[model samples]
Target: MDWITHDEDVWFDFRGSSPEQLTPGRFYKGTVDGFADFGVFVDLAPGVTGLLHRSELDRRLESLDWESGDTVFVQVKNVRSNGNIDLGWSIRQSESEFRGAHVHDPDGDEDGERIEADDGGPEPVRKTPKGISTESRATNGTESGDELSADATAEQKRVEAEHDETRESEAETVEPAETVSAEPDVVEATTSDESAGVEQSAESHEAEGTPERAAAEDADEGTEAEETAERTEGPAAEPERVTVESLGDRTGDRVRIEGEVVGARQTGGPTIFEVRDETAVVDCAAFVEAGVRAYPEIGEGDVVRLDGEVELRRGELQIETEELTELVDEAADAVEQRLVDALSAKARPETVEPLADHDAVAAVTEQITDAAEAIRAAVLQSRPIVVRHAATADGYVAGAAIERAVLPLIRDEHSRADAEYHFFTRRPLDDPVYGMDAATNDVTRMLQDNERHDEKLPLVVLVGVGGTTDSLDGLGLLGVYDASRVVVDADAVDTEVVEEASVLVSPSLTDTGAADLSTGALGANLAAAVNADVTDDLSHLPAVSYWEDTPEAYRDIAGGVGYDERRTRELREAIALEAYYQSYQDKRELITDLLFEDGGGLAGHVSQQFRKKLDDEVATAKANVEARTVDDVDVAVLDADSYSHRFDFPPTSLLADTLSRRDDSAVTVVYATDELFVRTDADIDVRAVAGAASEAVPEGGVTAVGVRQNRIEFLSGARETVVDAVVDAVVAQI
Candidate 1:
């Protein structure tokens, strides 16, 4: 057998090139091919395989949880002439646990072999195959044979014999000295073991990679020629292929990406397409010409290949597209399948057990899951979450719960400290039913943000509101721009509203008259599902929403978590006062502190003010409220224009609430000379009341308005007649 010696530098340069060239004393990331009685078979690469013997393992072989396709780290021990590979054990079971662990490939990227050893010193000597030994001088002036193992010598001789036969067979074509251009400095070793013991056949693998690599090289050469003709510098080296999420490290570097177009829009100078691969979504901008479409045919859900440079624009990562092409046939199907596999890993939660104690909540658990997914997806896509809720204590608590959960996620996912303020916003509405006025304000602000700052359209979330068909016009307006909407409410939602919203969480949709559940309860559970980290912080909000007669389950849950009935009431009172003061402002930080922070000082002080103002309003309303029995139904009617505060702190609706609570009336309706607002526990259609009043008093100018708000209007001259007619009409309906 022929023996050859190489310097340490030459050995360091060699790595896994071919089956016979697989070097020992090197580390590799391999795939578990199969398990045998003696050891596990590891496939290092297409033509390189090794056996990880059971005896070398630190633990019992049976204890390993590795499956066939699982990735592992192994050290090459020896290579036998029969093409049998021996692998040593590794203390590290995961790739992340090791430093400088790389894909050991001799013909891979140029920088692939530059991995640094942990100790900055020479590694222990390992036996090499025959004609590939490294001779090192003994520092102690003595030679020792301990470095060579018995099996290694025998294996080396067998490899030499196999090599001699291979050389004889290829004598007709191979020269005495042959080299591989891909690895120019490396020596080529001929082996006759066509049916090698590797996990994959070498002949078949070479057949597969040959044509693809040839075509790629030709295309690259053509591109280089074109680039050389145009400029001194040849074509920029083909960009590295990467997923969208990996773009963070590749900023300012060119990259090639493939993904489906989840969203697309036109700006003044560029066309932006939101490309979402399985990993993440990134916006790609293509500027073909000013105000001109870059790719006129590409639309949402179409798979496309993109070549671009990653750039940070306004604190967000975007791709500057240089080349774009739509994928078709097999390529399209493959891309689609990859996305489906990723989406499958994000399946809907199996159950909402802890949050679904009540039957009503249990019924709408599926809808709750959908809502949570939408909220989380918005955060992931870097879209701001805009919350709209009524300016009521209950509405405020619900909105605050979502805010608490979302702000933490924004902070954790984004680097900027002010991302919370920029990405999450809560706005108070005048009342339930996201009306035209509130929607118009949102649309105007979002459009301004998108135009001035190039911001993506915000995800509009409606809490304690937007559950009825009365809000359709406003929702449809948002839908026109393709802005996603998620509605969470405890009110009885109409069927059409449920269908229109991207996600609707309302127990009443499952069963009629199941509207006793509070919005805070629904939002709290949803908040927990949206970000599990904030679940404990939001558990008490549901109890705090109930002014009185809180559910036993929710009350216990709150008390067990430290918020008692008194504390809950204090929070409710504080939110109510805060909700009324500006009526328009959301008061995000103040509400967050009063609910989540220690010390009851803020809540106690606010509750005292709440009590005094509410008491004074109730006493005056009770003294002036005119009560009379009409057709066996006790009716309490108040002329709000004459006695109660209309434009002051206590709104007409709150006044009506106080009047109904103080009096023993079965029905209470408050109105001005022209407007009517009704609040009652009895089953009555206030819209029907307005209609009947218009028919009964035809001469009086009467109109039914704000069905969701239970409001109606009439002429001033017919005030007394209209009030009497409304009382008669309501009494008859009841």
Candidate 2:
């Protein structure tokens, strides 16, 4: 094998130019010279034979349809000394798909496929491959259910491996399986003698991966995606090859084209239809209107070689072909084209819907949440469900209780948080909530006098409720209180509440009794769900769980969140996020209500307990509100308006967008769930006018009203109930 110091700027040791130097990404059509369980080897020219995997042999379809002498188009992948080459194939019977198939040459943009990203894109064209991308199916596998699914799960990602911009670095750092490049650095295998004294290949796995395990991990959602990292190969590997030469109307040079056959004449017309490259696809009319030339029989997955000038016919990439060849390299190429056609034929690219790409964390969170939701749904649907929530006791914290109540419905073990207090207390509760009362005047007074705020302002939010110690019921109010305190603490903490802190109002049994967490909250049925849109802030926070009960539990993880059942932990996190969302949204509304309204912020107020406060500090507040009809509402509302929030962060917004805010100042959603009851020392019949929502919010939906604020409270119910109520509330008149 000697280097060819010939006219070509290519280098070769012996078995032809490398995969990098192959033209049109294909060597040429060859015949099967050998067959093995692994694949069928095809002889291209003389010294080269390409491989067609056994996997490519259609089991359900007719094998007789394909013969040894069958002329196929193929692109050369790896060139083995023994003349073994990897052949790409497709069983698609479509003429166009057959004509356009090519190998994995990076020179031009004959890419693999597009993925279902979370970021919404315009609807796609091909509708065949459900949950599959047009781009990927177009260039990879066949779009049958079994094959498509398998492809999604096992196909190797071949793009330039680089995290997309959507990969938010500031997000929780996840150990990436393959972060360096698309093609993992090759490692040579070493042989070792085992028990039988037989030689075995030992592939010392790298620090972050094992192909099997990694593959499984990626397949969790059927598809793993990386941005299209350009790696040019094939004839177009060099930009010079992509150029087309218009040689005196006959033989052209440097022309690269991709397309499907619309019409192939056994003798006359040039293949009709189109040829697509990187930027755009072009419609090319064949030049052989001459004597019946082999009908230019271009089948699907066959790469049409355009040896003539590239004429842009009405904005289309129309190439006149002097030669026609099949892209018979890796069988994957043909499969991909057929898959694309099937997908496109199944539907149009415009119809394929774009999906939102979930980040690792978001994905994990979504899975967990979806599992929880599934459990909740099954229980409520299949079986009789009475979602439980408590006034004070019963058995559960906002996150943990819901997790327990619905655990039975879930077949997967990952839905549970694994531990109660530890995980739930991450953003724990604190401070005994003390409010004036939800009266119009008090809310108004509180809103106007933004400063001199006391623990007894119209609303006082308790953060994280502590974890359960003894019986679940005993952990109710106190637990809610503890958890509440934990949630409100402005600073991050790392301790779990060992006392009866993780309690909450059981959504299950309206019965206000201690809880029984050990039973997993079954039997008595459960209650409703908390809102995910709320933004209530937390206070007196406790520490979160740092370590799990077992060490080996998390052996499979790279960054264990202190447990082996990482999936379970993920589910817990998702629930917590939803709860947090509800609480946050609730808080935002409370603030908006307290600070606005034409009737004057807090247009109504009649809290007996707060009345005492009014009597106690009425003078100080009146003095504050007296100024400017006083823009107390404007002042208080404006003070905190500088911040932006998100249940869904805006894509265009900066990453630093705040989830919670206080500015060391005005209003905040410090804990809205009844996990911790915000109480007023004084009890009284408080009738407060909370805008027009007063009607929409049924007396029952308003679980616990603020002892002081005009319209602050907790609202929870069955998923459907809450979803409907929320939708209605949001769609309410401006």
Candidate 3:
């Protein structure tokens, strides 16, 4: 038996665990998805996939109609991690077939698909009865095929099928109800037609692929469960077998933990990385005994299922590995993970290595980590993580914890979720999905540092409390935004999808002179302040309207730095364009990849959706201004993702001062990002100019022309008309 150490143990001192001798194939046992049809996918061990084909689903199932969601019962087959093994097994087969014989009649070898080839070829496929096959034999060779006991297998499969049919006929007397609530409920008792009709009101369960038999079983005349048993299995002296059920809620002997992966932590010793699944992170030590690298690879966002004893390790409840594996068979999850992974790589290519393309949760964790840090710093400094909230005064907000503590005076979470701000964090990060110690700590630090000095730091925390859930603390960081941040805490709300962590500024500076707010300086400021450089002439910003437009009006409201509307619009457009490109590019890639699955060459469904969306964008570019810009740049309506920026330094300047990042004396930014930018007087057109752009292009098939009201459209083939209409509308606005 594999024994897991308690939390207090040194072994538990590690953030994760190493593979032990006991936690392998036989160690993992799970109830097969009893209702599974076609195939049953299982994890015989961590990061392993085993498939039980429909042919082995049941003796009766092969010839019957099977639907997609039908679940079944399964267990680990022989496991050789280094070598692949057919991972599925079944019961309910003929005795001969179960003994490793072909289920097809030798005389009927008309197709030879089920035959042991005369020449060296695959062994005739055989079925099993005990739901387990302990033998190991080559699946190929004529020598292998000549050694056969399978004539019985073929006869048995046919017998099992016929017997099942007979039993099903008798079972009609029994009332049809929900597909077996569980495998265990199919009892040995027989039910007859009278009792079923009189009491239970037997409803017909249309078994898949089953045809109506003209003569009903005579045994079904009376109501009895044993009668149904006879109907299903024929005249069996043995009782019907009971299968284990999946009681969704675990009040029994086990606990089911489920969640997304957010972050990874490492102890001082091990080289293995932690696999942070959402339910809770677990210790996955690499395996070295098999002469293979243990902890070979582990990345964030891997979906996992673990059945282990709930042990308290260092005050944390973690499972001590009875069973665990990455869930990779589901198509939707796999696709989502691939997109997020690609995005994360593009966003932060340096700090982390690429995790598997299938771990979506892991990539999102990385994103949360990045976004949270930016917001944390902005809030810690005097910058507000601004956004457009309908009823708030500031028009932006902070983490929930900050909001609750500061809202008594500030009164809003405005548009924080969508604003530009810097975020900061402590090293070796730790917290729940929303993060820990720091969500509130940054604000606390600001207050304390200010209090110790009493003149500079004014603690103004902003939060979003209206979006509360059962798991949320009234004023925690998670309450402000649902987007998860990278942290280890399970109690906090930061690991979900609706909110994010950020800091809100009340814009309290009353200075009537000086440049006021430093553009793109909040993150560096906090970093500097924490490092004891608080006197950097960092001007505080004045409040401005969420919908305010134009540099002059912005300046009038700000009173110090002129509102950089051109810059902000430019930035906004860039951000939109970048986001749009990401969306569409991923669509193109996914579609392109679909042509490869099982030799498919067709575009994927996502690609179809993206193309359709682009076609629509071409048709309605002008009126739908926000949707028109990829972020801000308008390109050929059909290929907005292919649009390149033309504004040069122009669009780069339309951002809020708080959004740009400062190194020392200079601020730097990518033009097509951030929906707002700082407009330094520049000659470049903020949007694309068709006359100039077309002339600039070397003679091409179709040239992209101009920008209108921040919308960019292009000239092309059939796509040109749509682009023309959209660009024409926007150009009229400009």
lDDT of each: 0.67, 0.27, 0.27
The residue pairs in collision within model 1 are none
Model 2 segments more than 4 A misplaced: 1-397, 400-679, 684-734
Prediction 1 global C-alpha lDDT: 0.67
What clash count does candidate 2 reach? 170
Best to worst by TM-score, what's the order? 1, 3, 2
Per-residue alpha-carbon lDDT of model 1 for 1-111, expressed as tens digits?
423323212223234545566667766666664443234556676435566755566744434556555666677777666465667887665433444433345566753
Model 1 stretches astray by more than 4 angstroms: 1-241, 244-255, 260-276, 281-351, 354-356, 699-709, 715-717
Task: Using TM-score as the measure, name the better of candidate 2 and candidate 3.
Answer: 3
Q: How far is candidate 3 from the true structure (C-alpha RMSD, Å)?
A: 25.6
Q: Compared with the true structure, what per-residue lDDT tens digits does model 2 show for residues 414-461?
A: 222442221121111211122222112223443443333221121111
* Candidate 1 residue-pair clash tally: 0
lDDT value, residue 192 of candidate 1 = 31
What is the TM-score of each predicted model, taking all chains together?
A: 0.61, 0.19, 0.21
Per-prediction backbone clash count? 0, 170, 121
Q: List residue ranges in candidate 3 displaced over 4 A.
A: 1-253, 256-503, 506-519, 524-734
